[model samples]
Target: MDHAELTTEQVLNRDIPWETYMTTKLITGTCLQLLRRYDKRSESYRSQLLDDDGPAYVQVFVGILRDIFKEETVEYVLALIDEMLTANPKRARLFHDSSLVDKDIYEPFLRLLWKSNWFIQAKSCKILALIVSARPKPQDGSAANGEASNSKRKITTIGDVLKGLVEWLCAQLKKPSHPSRGIPTAINCLATLLKEPVVRSSFVQLDGVKLLVPLISPASTQQSIQLLYETCLCIWLLSYYEPAIEYLATSRALPRLIEVVKSSTKEKVVRVVVLTLRNLLSKGTFGAQMVDLGLPQIVQSLKAQAWSDEDLLEGLNQLEEGLKDNIKKLSSFDKYKQEVLLGHLDWSPMHKDPIFWRENITNFEENDFQILRVLITILDTSSDPRALAVACFDISQFVQQHPAGRVIVTDLKAKERVMKLMDHESAEVTKNALLCIQRLFLGAKYASFLQA
Candidate 1:
């Protein structure tokens, strides 16, 4: 029974049944305390949990969480996770080997998140974020389909766990007086969760914008500059989800974000502000709205203005990139051109059906009027012949596909650009432009605009 008499093998091989372990709190506390120690740096201490050649840790770890949550002893569970991550941070071998991804554990984690203890809620968020982060990303676009076999292997094993986690985080945000560190902590976890496209889509499905926008809006009174930064970061990361881009482009928080970027002296926050706006601008409507909102003046004021503070350069390049990028979308792909000008053209299932267009043309025209103009501008002013060629093709496709799209294109004076392109130096541009002109003539009302 003496401590010195115990062999390393004996300790490493020890197993506790769930029924017996939860019978007494002392045994439960000691196991968690030991795991917590392993989380720290130590010499001459080789935990049995770290055996170079030992049994997989998944069961042991899950057993502890199961028993702890069953008994409602939530205090030390997070420490165990923290220690596992800290001890082997680069690999997080223990956590990856554990049943953290197993669906059965979700109930307990969810229960812990709702506890009155904000720290417990924060830790639960962290643990869930880490588990989701550990998921293996798919190798190709085909893997994105939900029916793909790899879908079953996702990190969040429970179907609704991630959705529930997002709901909880948003609920906390709606609270009037947030817990001391809960909001930022939840947002931090959200940033981690948002890295995955699937989870980004989930955030939108959960109505995250409604919850997050108020925190970053200029009108919000309880402004923690840090909160705004995190909010912007989340929104920026989510913008990469193409399905979600339209919503972000149209959100009311957009103008407020511009105000923050223009006025805030904080470079880190401004970096997110610019990155987010830049992302939204990739969608043609947001780019046009920037013009509609008079964003040009703000970008002009900040252009090349030196910041004496060294800290201001934290995201200066990126902030400049945002401004530089926006200029291209605003202009005619001229000298100020920032990024490739294009739109999503791979028609979705709904878009391919003709009946869908007839019913949706009104909304489609309102949505696409500015984008159509962007294409027209590119066709007219871009010196890059290939860009002009693509612009002509895009316009031609829009007119042929959308109901009354040809009429709209002609009404916008696109006919002038199309006719001019017929003599363009690049044969590709001339060909595509000729195609667009042909499409234009098919319209009922192209003659007035087509006349020289």
Candidate 2:
């Protein structure tokens, strides 16, 4: 059977030779007795044994993983550990018990991450993530659980463990070992791990943020939707970290997220994407981007739905309000500044609104004519005819509205760039370039008449 096809239930049904392992001194007598009691037992029976001697079972399992090289034994032990943690994740803390302080519990699982088949690798990644997360945080160079005496012993540092796990997870995302389950498993673990600041930093440092953008789409199947949900969950968690947010701002993450939220009917998917949008809405130019993506209408549409998740409803409301405020802000100078600075010029209403120019014209002079300089640069460098045309129009508007409009435009050497566009192929570009020249040479008074 393919190791990737092995399930926990299938692996658990195997009868292992615990007595043989004990006879060979591979496992202690105590470990044999524990395994006998644990193997083939009812779920309740196993739960009771673990509840009574959870750390001992953890120790035995880690010992077998560290010492045993048999694939069957390793797979069996990992299944046992996986089942144990899956039943009660709080049992993960057993691996960090004060009694096991000297043991390198993380080493075995971290080693298994790269050594074994898909089943072993996947289980190892999951178990490692659980135990590492459940470990007592260190303080004053001591374990928080009072396991400080073994601090001098060589053990796997949490930093090394997390870094290893992140690397493995990223590898899985980049190229899955298991055809169907690998990416989902990686994303699932990341959704849990990214709550840690170190994980977030490591993920961003490894360029893991881009790996997630491709997964942030609407999913139809139950499995794919869950993957999408968890993927977005990872993104939602990342939204709080500033460095990840910086990466997200530049990537297609916003548009992809907006697309998911716009089309997804699943409330959980909608909820998470909305929360991410709300987090990013306040940072940098995300608000403007969200408005540009038409998120306000999406938010309104979402609010009309009868979502049961309180957080989802609350997020939709907050996003709606934020988008509303963003719309108002976009209608003002901030929107124009964002458009110009980003060099994505278009024939938005701001370009033709005389009132918009009359009000915000002098505001452009505040940044050493930074807005005007970018427009001129756009004329020189931009290949998008709409951008070139809009740049010409905006320069013409600046000349028409600002008090030193003509002097400022000419002194910035924008006249040559605008003249260069006058003979361009795109009529929009040429017409706007001619209008700009008229405003520059003919002054705003005569230019206004021509515009009329």
Candidate 3:
């Protein structure tokens, strides 16, 4: 007996209940048949089936079909499509035509999952995110016709619905699970939905930045981290439109961003951090404000990172463009310089005076020694106390490292200055002088003289 031959009443009155039939693969297969029939220009089958109700019925039937198709017979699948297209063209058009209107019919199931249990809700969010993200984007300079007319310029109600759903999803993610699935799906959904400015703004308004901050680390799964990257990108967009900077700076985002920037793994996360910083600093004078609020820590981190000088150079270059006259403040390392340099022993600046003094202490007889001697002659002509201190320290460390270079350090004037710096206010210079003193005693064969 043909399954379609059974009347709705007969079907409802059968040994199985309507709920069972509605859920079974038979009904799902039947609906897909009806939908495909409608796709093929068969109006009569669609009318017969769709006459049961409006969009809500169509939605319920579609949802049921989604539930049942996995178990249905192949023959039933073919017949249902044939019936639906024969019955109603408009209803068939929903599937045959891949457009925003078609997506409308399928989106409700995702929305419905908001009220479902954990696993179902997570799956629904993933599916919905896929649908939303996969929707056709508008083209440039295309005719403002067809689906464009249906797709309004304003933000859709869909974004609001999605935002609320994601908020609920994120709340559930606070729990530990048998398998951690909810967060990844929810983040994917959030990323997809956030493609819209309105959706992105909604997330920002709902403290989404704070929620996303915790998820930015590479410790999270790759997909989860990618979702985080997308979320950060979304936040980057929001940074310009809303008070996102205020939120990012105040919330956990700033620290997480700094951590990612400093992390040895995850350069992509670091790239996003750079972008987020760029956005935060976009307001010109506001960029300088970051210097006080943990910016120093971030800079300190960059200084210690493997690419310290390169990253610092880029960052300082950015700051210089933004601050113009006040850029010199960044180069001042009076407090952190010694520590940073100790950690980065290979760091050698291009400044001729420091470089010349460094090379002189290493090998004054080398080719560059003439240039170094000339620089030393010029330095001897100046009496700037700071200049004298730096030149003395540079030569002192070089000579200490290479015993042959102590010839340059034995100058009485340089010795007096080094002794003065031993009591210098800066602990860094004083530490260096103490170090040089030990080297001076060791190199001079004056061990007993030092004891005296």
lDDT of each: 0.59, 0.87, 0.48
Residues 36-67, model 3: lDDT tens digits? 44433444554654565444334444455344
lDDT of 2 by residue, 1-452 (tens): 88989988888888889899889999999888888888888999999988888889888999999999999899999999988898899998898777887778888888999975999999999998888778776653437232344467677777788889999999999999998999999999999999889899999999999999999888999999999999999999999999999999999999999999989999888889999999999999999888766676677777888899999988888988887788676657877776776677888887899898888887888759888898899988888999999999888988888878999889989998888888899998899899889889988767778782
Instruction: Judge candidate 3 against the unseen true structure and give its global Cα lDDT, from 0 to 1.
Output: 0.48
Q: lDDT of candidate 1?
A: 0.59
Candidate 3 regions exceeding 4 Å error are: 1-107, 136-156, 173-179, 217-231, 284-286, 289-452
Q: Least accurate stretch of 10 residues (summed lDDT) in model 3?
A: 334-343
Clashing pairs in 2: none
Tens digit of per-residue lDDT, candidate 1, span 1-452:
33223333333333334335535653465555444444333423534546641123433454565565532234444554555554555434334332233324445566667776555566667776665555444553322111233325543343466777777877777672245566777777787777766677777887777677766753333457777777888887877887667666567778888888777766667667766776676575676666555565566565567755443444445444654565555533221112223322222343334454345445435435655676688765668776777677656666766767777888899999789879978897888788778777775344224321
Instruction: Provide the RMSD of all predictions against the true structure, rounded to 1 decimal.
Output: 16.2, 9.4, 14.7
Top lDDT prediction, candidate number: 2
Q: Local error of candidate 1 at 406, Å?
A: 44
What TM-score goes with each of the models? 0.54, 0.73, 0.48
For candidate 2, what is the TM-score? 0.73
Q: Pick the candidate with the highest TM-score.
A: 2
